[model samples]
Target: MKLYIAEKPSLGRAIAAALPQPQKNQKTHIELANGDVVSWCIGHILAQADPEDYDAELKKWRMENLPIVPEQWQLKPITRTRAQLTVLRKLVKQADEIIHAGDPDREGQLLVDEVIDYFKLSKTKKNNIKRLLISDLNLPAVKRALSSLKANSDFMPLSISALARSRADWLYGINLTRAYTLQGQKTGYHSVLSVGRVQTPLLGLVVRREQEIAAFVSKPYYQVQAHIALTSAEKVAFTAKWQPSENCLPYCDEEGRVLVKALAENVVQRIANQPALVSHIDSTEKQQAAPLPFNLSQLQISAAKQFSMNAKLVLDVCQALYEKHKLITYPRSDCRYLPKEQLKQAKGIINTLANSSLPCNKPAQGADTSLVSKAWNDKQITAHHAIIPTEKSPENSSLNTFEKNIYLLIVRQYLLQFYPAYIYQQTKVHLLIAGGQFLSQAKMEKQLGWQVLFPKSKKAKTVNNSNQKQHESEQEKTLPPLTKGQTLHCQQGELIAKQTSPPQSFTDASLLAAMTGISRYVSDPAIKKVLKETDGLGTDATRAGIIDLLFKRDFLQRQGKAITATEVGVALINALPEMATLPDMTAQWEATLTAISEKKANYLSFMQPLTAIVTEMVQGASQQSFSGLPQVAFKPKRRKKTFTKKVARKTG
Candidate 1:
């Protein structure tokens, strides 16, 4: 019988439902009418060989042996997952043909590959064998994939890359954790000290910010403002604000009030004589495109900002949408655009969710146009397009508040493609008053277009808006009629006091943003152009997890959504060479991997260097002395978080 191995049980069940085979029975196994027996993995049934797996003596953690690199790696059942392994063993023993079905991304590839390694399936499968790569489990996609299944050999390099990364992480995660934990034990703190390549680097960013905050010395600065009446207003209105041309003034300190008044009177004499003139009128309109589809990083950022949703929660909900509801495409996609072929499904996708979609604040632009965006490239779209709804009505009521928000964000963008681009007019006018210049700025929308998709954010920015002061919409900054040479009456107004503000601290939302777009950060012209053309080191699926891992390990701490580094994180970053923490290291690694992916470079050649470097990291980490470990003492926020995700319902 043909044995079909699916990534998970739910997927296996779906595959069986689509096949002609009836029940081929085993514990948690099902058979279809076509005699294809299908079984699934609960994520992973096998894992990388740990040092403990080598022998009983190796199980004990000791520094005497230093780096424990196994000459030949062993495979074993995941202890917590052996229940599923038993079922897999029964099927693997009897099947004539084995179909390798797993998730399409790197992680998915790794998981399925591990199971096959555990059973040594590749060496035995010399007959009719195939592996299906699929992004989603919809019937059409599954059928299409089955008809085109390639031999397991087709993905050997990808499998090699996956295994290499896992082994590397094992060497890194196990060695570093043990070494660091032992050091903490030596120092009298029994806390489990964990360190990782990405985790430590991420923590360093937070700790650095925290240190900056702790070391900050507040400096007070002075500024001036004035109140003035414009045109024919009977009463003086609005705060006419400007700094003196001299840029300095004297202030009374305690008993110096009289001394200050004497200086102020002289300065007031000079201020009263000068005329304020409108020097220039300048206004321009810009179309702020709706953000790209929700990449994992983008989703994390939006969830944190819009619903105060945690990164982990967003991933969980998305997994549900993909696995349980089967209502959306892949959950952990890095790309925000669909492959060109999927563009044809646009009409069906729009119709399926016609009822579930909400009105966008601004109408979407460009969906109907034949003109396509670079985001929609076919070759770049490896497994799937950006996360989108399946071609069926989403069971809207079944969705929770936050899921609803995310799904709507997807729909809004998809629909937006059909709309026109945002159009607006900008106007700037400057006038002259007395001897000084006054300016005005305004924006008027010619058409809302796709701007409607990302509605005016409901999250309000708190400001002191009193009726006594005109409450101007942030969108509307109106200016009075004025010309470049326009003149205004010179009127003396009160000088107002303001202080210079410190640079804002990084928020989780902002930190993710700061991490993207390497081209913006690179100073060298050549480097910037190169980065602009390539995908950065970490994929969308991995970056947030890397950041979250840092927080979980106490390398980073969150105070309300703001991330800060702990002392340990800061020290670790400083301890490592500067290149270790820079994203370029990851970029460099990815560049080589891409070369392997394209057959331009051999996988072993690319990995051989990493193995040597990792060997040093593994062997050397245990002996390296650390001065101290950082402890995080943070108070959690008390306010209840607001959320906007709604559970997506399954359509019958």
Candidate 2:
């Protein structure tokens, strides 16, 4: 009997349904009329054994076994899902051939592969094992995948990388958490102080941003504006603001916030009521391409920014859309570009949208199918394509408010690819007034294009108003036809005083963006370069969880829409070593992990350096003396009990 093992029951059922007229066998396993078996793992059935599993003495938190590296790594069944593991093992024992039908990512690869290793199936029954890779759980996608089963050994690199990541996290997080918690205990603090590879670094970002905001002192500045009126043949006048030239320095700061009120008053007095000549008027047509489709991180950030939904919730909704509703493709994709082969599927998807009663706003119902965009390059496609709607139409589908909003977001982005680029005419006018250079700029929308699908809300408009006010001289207005040397009246001049604000506190959107583009945060040029080559802080599949972990750990607190680091969080960063909290160590590991994925490095090669670093961190942490241990005098809040034994999930 052929057995198909999937990551989860939903995926298992989807696979079973897609198989050719498969018959349900006791609902435990689906059997093809020709004798086949289908079963699933409830995520991970077997996880890397915890330190407690290594020995009884290790169970009690002790600093003596500071750096516990398992000489022989152990795998044990997750207690909650041991029954599922039992059922899977039984099927594995009976099946003539086994198919590894897990998720398409590294973790997914490890989920089933680890099960095989747990049962000692690979060493004994290697010849009959095969791998299946599928992005979407849709019937057609599953069918397409069934036709292309690869050898199980082919994904060994992915398995190796996943195992390496888990083990490394175990070495660093297990050892360091014990070391730090014991040290804190010495200082009368009793808390399970966690440490992790990506979680600590993420917390550091929030803490540093909060520090900047707290330490910031606003400085006052001033800018001179000359409001000018221009005339056309129709006797109608268009208003324009005079922009200051480069010489307006000493009067302004680096951000162009005018710093000297006296200098601004002098300029306003000198230029007020002066005849302003249109020295140069230039108009250029510009086109802005539609945004690329939603990768998981991009979608998370967008959902957070637009709707104030947290990253974890957005991911949950997207996953529901992919797994439950079946209205969208894969949700955890890292790639924002579609494969060229998927271009054929785009038209059908567009037609489906056009026919369906979309969940988008009323104005977005009419999607333009004629706008073929530039996001269909195969070369840019990664492991999976961007998150998009499946061929299945969501018309008349049952969706709650959140699901509706997320679905609409994905649909709108997908449909936008077919819309024309946002076209506009940019008008730049350089003016001469009383021996001072002033500039005026304006944009006239030629075509709304894809932008029509996503109209900015009032809040967004208010936020953009600052940008508009920043370029005070370039007001958005219709420019009347004017030639060189044409004189215009400067109706009024005013010196406006403004204060320079500190960097804004991170929202889920901004923080996720920082995590994704972490190279910008790294001060080390060499490390930054490597981080750029590898995915930052955490993988796309893991970033949302990392952010969620911070909230759970009380490292970050949400104030309205902004995220601020807690005092405990800041104290933690101060207490920890830079090697543990900084992005450099994790970045180097990510680089080596990528090398492992690309076959440039083996598990031993990657783990050797990582193991050494973990040893060094544990030693440093053990010997180092911390001041006061950042005692937050409050009882730990009661929440859902979180499992900490898993190496894959940790928050430092």
Candidate 3:
């Protein structure tokens, strides 16, 4: 019988039931009529041993043997699930072929592969098994995968990547933890010092943001506003403003506050400055096409903004929709489009979902799959298409608020791909001040096009008032039909003072935005250009986890819907080396890993550099530089002698 291993018992049971009427459990393993024997693992049934496991002496803190770099890592049957392992061993031994039917992701791949490698499963030519990967743990996809089973070697690259990532993490995590723990003990610290490659960098991200907030100094600026009566014939009513002189735009005093009084001092400057008059009036019509489909990053961002849901929550909702409800495509996908042949399936999915509780508001009749050209590129899809609803009616109608929003978001965006481009006209009017050195004007907008699709985007999303006003202005304006070159009389005008503000610290959303351009900060234009040509900092699948790592370690905190860093986080990262300071660590890793994925770079090339750098970082952080914070001192210390106690002893 062909052997099938699923990630968990629930999924295994689901797969088994989907097969042709299963025979009663006969022997050691559960057998199915399709000639498939299904078994499962509970997370990790085997893993590498701890440093202390290697030797009894290794358990003690010893700085001399800090870096416990194992020549070849070893694994043992997980103690907690030894009973399940016995069942798995019996099943694999009797099976003719084995199918790695785990969750379709890196962790899943690694976990399943680890089991096969652990027990030395049959590697004979008699075995013709392969991985069965599909978005949801449903019947149709599972049966389809079974009918088309290929050899396991076909997915060697994916298997290799999974192994590498896990091993790399192990190497770094183990050594650093041991090193830091020993270092702490030496400094009279009794607690564990946890260090991880991803965790450290993630903490650094939060810490950097904290520093920006802590050091921020707000500067104020003044504007000269005049209430003016629109001409009688025009019968217009609006406020007017004197163009702040280039020099006096932000008339700052020594303390750097905006000089509101300075504007009053310059009355002559106001009369001479005059109000900004409309010099040019231009109007045109334009349309904004619907946005591209939901890549994981895009989905996370939209969900976060719309429902205050984190990436992990959105991912959880997607998993439920895919696995439990069986009404959505893969959730952890990087691609937002499908291949040409996938159009049929797309139509079917839409039709299927239309009947689901997650029904579409509009008719799905005119969904010309061809019209979604921007989203339809075969080359972009590797593992799965965007997270679209599946053919099955959702069994998850009672989804939480975040889950519902994410599901609705994916559905709306996917449906919009077929919707016709929104049509509208836009208008802009600029007025030139009567007396100013060509620097002041008034402007307005006429029409809103596809902006209607996204009310949030159409409105200014920022908290800043001036920016909000600017967006509101260009979005819509009622201008009395004034032709170009119409000189308007200004009854009143005044000069205003303004000052430039320092850039604001990046928010989590903005941080993700910045990470999209890791190459932007590079000094060498050539390198920067190459980074531009490359993908964003981390893949859609990894960035969310990266941010999660930051939050888990107390580095990042959610303070009233805003992400900020803790003091310990700041101190820890501030002590890091220059290389660790750069967020491009994620990008660089991805670039090299992508090359490895493409076979352009050797595995050693990527591994050696990271290994060397991490070694150096561990050594560097070992030194003490903390202040007003808790840190494990990485060195032994002499016992302190209290002066008061010593004096009492001497007197006695």
Candidate 4:
């Protein structure tokens, strides 16, 4: 009998629907007409055994058993899914052929492959196993994936990489958590000090930001603005900001903000009613293409910003849209570009959207399907393409408020690829007044184009210009026609006093953005490059969970829209080593894992150093004193018991 093993039940049903009909649906397996059976796992049916599973002595948390490295790692069936495993075991033994169907990502590959390994199949049987990779649950997409099956052995490296990551995390997390929890107990803080490869570094980000905010001291700065009136027929007026010359260096701060009130006042007095010459004028027309389609991280950040939704909540909504509603493709995709071959589906998808009652229906109808944006590059495709709407219409999907909002967001982003670029003109005017340099800038929208799709309330006021100085103010205005050497009258100079503001606390949007772009936080160029190449500290599939873990562990707390580290969190970060708290180590591990997946690096080379690092960390932690940490009351968890009722009246 031919057997098909899927990653989950929903996927199993999807695979069965694409196969030959006349199938009998049983509780555990589906039997096809041709003696073929399809079975599935519930996420991971097997997990790495805990430290205590290796030895009884390690059951109790103690510093003496600090580094628990297992010589032969063991896998135990998760209690909740043992029944599913039993059914799979029976099917595996009866099958003559097997097909491994899993999600096309690393974790998905390992989840199914590990189950196959647990069955202890013969070498020939293992070699004969076929792999099915499915990203979209739509029938056409599933059928296409079914026709392109490859040998499961070809992905052994990917499985191996995942295995290494799992084991490494276990070793690092279990050892450090035990060690730190023990040390924290010495300070009367009895709560478990959980440390993870990603979560700890993420918590560190919040703690450090809190520290900076606490230590910040505001300082006053002064600026000089000249209210200038054009001497032309139009009689247009605009505000020009003072640009300090080399002579004003002594009175200016590092950011060119004048520190001395007297200096600013003198400039204001001198420039008052002065004749200003328009020495130079720069006018340039710029076109901005629509942003690429939603990657998971980008989508999460957008949802967090626009709707105040948490990262986990956004991911859940995307999953519902993809799996339940069949309205979107993969939700956990890291790639923001679509495959060129998929471009043919644009017209169908756009038509479906236009016919639907979505808020973006008008934009979809107006979209030029022939105009392909830069988002359709095959070379940039990763494990999965960008998250995009499928050809399926959402008219009868019965989506909730969150689901509909996120679906519309994804559809709008995809439709933007077929819209024209937003065109605008930027004008910069350099002026001279009383031997001082003044600057004025304005931006005029030449064409709304794709920008018209966004509501006026949601539109950004200004575009980011990296070259623009901090003191420069950009306004939306239409400057009167003027040439070089033209004179304008400075009606008056105003002195604006401002205080330097501390960095804003991280909101859900900014926090996710930080995780996605963690390279910007590092100082070392090598580490920065690695982080950028690896796409930051954690994968899109795992980042939300890591952030959620921190909150559950009391390492992070939410203050309205901002996320801050708790007292325990700050103390834990202070107690941990710098390497554990920073993202550099995680970036390096990610690089090594990527190399392992590419077959350029081996498991031993990565694990040996990791084990050594864990050993050193354990040894170092054993000697450290955590007495300075705040005391936390240990709350023991209460386990609920279930009672079975018996018929007492049976004897009567």
Model 1 ranges with Cα > 4 A deviation: 55-57, 86-97, 117-131, 144-157, 221-285, 356-375, 428-440, 457-474, 480-497, 500-508, 514-538, 547-558, 564-602, 611-652
What is the alpha-carbon lDDT of model 4 when measured against the actual structure?
Answer: 0.84
lDDT of candidate 1 over 1-652, digit per residue (tens): 8988888887887677667845676667887766668898987676655565576676555666546566787666767779888878878878888888887666676677777667765565733457777666677766766777888666666666666655555555565555555554554534545555445544545555566767776544332333344533333333343333333224533322222334434433444524545567676665544345666667777777777776677787888877777767777777777777777776666656554444432232234545454456677676446777666566544877777777666666566566666666667554344433333445566777655544454211211113213223434454555566554443554433333334456676666665555455445676666666655535566666766666655567777766777666666665454544555544555556556654667767765676676556655554544556554333222110000000000000
State how far residue 417 of model 3 sits from its true place (Å).
Answer: 1.5
Q: Which TM-score value belongs to model 4?
A: 0.94
Query: Model 1: how far is 300 from its true place, Å?
Result: 1.8
Write one digit per residue (lDDT tens) for candidate 2, span 1-652: 8999999988999888888774865555666787888898989788778766778777766667778888999988889889888888898888888899888878888889889878886564776689987787878878888998999788888889988888888788778777887777677666767789889988888888888988999999776777786532223254444455678766666766667777778878987667778898899997878888988998888888679898899989988898998998888888888887777676677777767766453433455555567888888764578899888878767988889889888887788787777777778888888888787777676787777776543312322344755333333356777788898877667778778889999998999988888899899999888888777778888888888888887888989888998877877788888777777778778878878876889999888888888788877875656664666453342210133475444423
Clashes of each: 62, 3, 10, 0
Q: Rank the candidates by lDDT, best first.
A: 4, 2, 3, 1
Off by over 4 Å in 4: 232-236, 461-475, 634-652
Per-residue alpha-carbon lDDT of model 4 for 105-211, expressed as tens digits? 78888888888899899999989999887888889889988999999888888889888888887787777877887888887987777777888888888999989
For all candidates in order, the CA lDDT equals 0.59, 0.77, 0.60, 0.84
Top candidate (TM-score): 4
Q: Residue 477: error of model 2 in Å?
A: 1.6
Clashing pairs in 4: none
Q: Which is better, 2 or 3, measured by lDDT? A: 2
TM-score of 3: 0.80
Best by lDDT: 4
Residue 614 of candidate 4: its Cα lDDT? 93
- For each candidate, C-alpha RMSD in Å? 8.5, 3.6, 8.2, 5.9
